[model samples]
Target: MAKETYQSLQAQIRKLQEKAETVRLKQRQPIVASILRSMQEYSITLDELKAAQAKGVSGRKRSVGTAKPAAKAPARQVAPKYRHPETGETWTGRGKPPRWLVAAEGAGATRDQFLIAQ
Candidate 1:
């Protein structure tokens, strides 16, 4: 009887350990995702700041010919692929632009224009 009780206790301990590990993993996943999102946001902001600085420096160059007003930087365009805004479903059909592209077109942008032009 004592041996049986010891075996049962061991099994319960093992099960508890497994449950604890699962709970720990569940708790960690959101933290990992949040960290990744923050990193991405920081990276994007850094890139934008760099681009703005470069543009400012370029604008200060002296020109000799007929001075043209600084041309607006082109928008950043992505591939002609379409992805759903909510589900991120990428469209693989023949020449079907992404949903974002469609929305931009609807907003009076030319077809194939990117959300951000450089």
Candidate 2:
């Protein structure tokens, strides 16, 4: 009888633990959502957070107060392959067409007309 009761109590504890975890997750959702919203509002990036953590580990004081802005990545510049003769507007012909190119195309202009002289 004691062994049966112990087994029953163990089963109850398992059921209670499952219920507690579900409740904990339900409670945590709002907190987690608020944290995400706050991070978005402040424009906090993951790299900034990691940098701050690294600074903390290294005993840096300045970075602890404010995260240092990451160095600006070099802008990728592709030489323009197409140019408008009149306006001199240039494009690399890579991504979406610029407004001028779109307008010219809409007006029955072929892309070959805009090709820069090599």
Clashing pairs in 1: 74-117, 74-118, 75-116, 75-117, 75-118, 76-116, 76-117, 82-98
lDDT of 2 by residue, 27-100 (tens): 99999999789889999877887887777753654445577858999999899999998989999999999999
Error of 1 at 117 (Å): 72
Best by lDDT: 2
Give the clash count for each candidate: 8, 0
lDDT of 1 at 56: 76
Compared with the true structure, all predictions reach lDDT values of 0.66, 0.88
- What TM-score, to 2 decimals, does candidate 1 have? 0.33
Instruction: Write one digit per residue (lDDT tens) for candidate 1, span 64-98.
Output: 79898788999766453444445555544346566
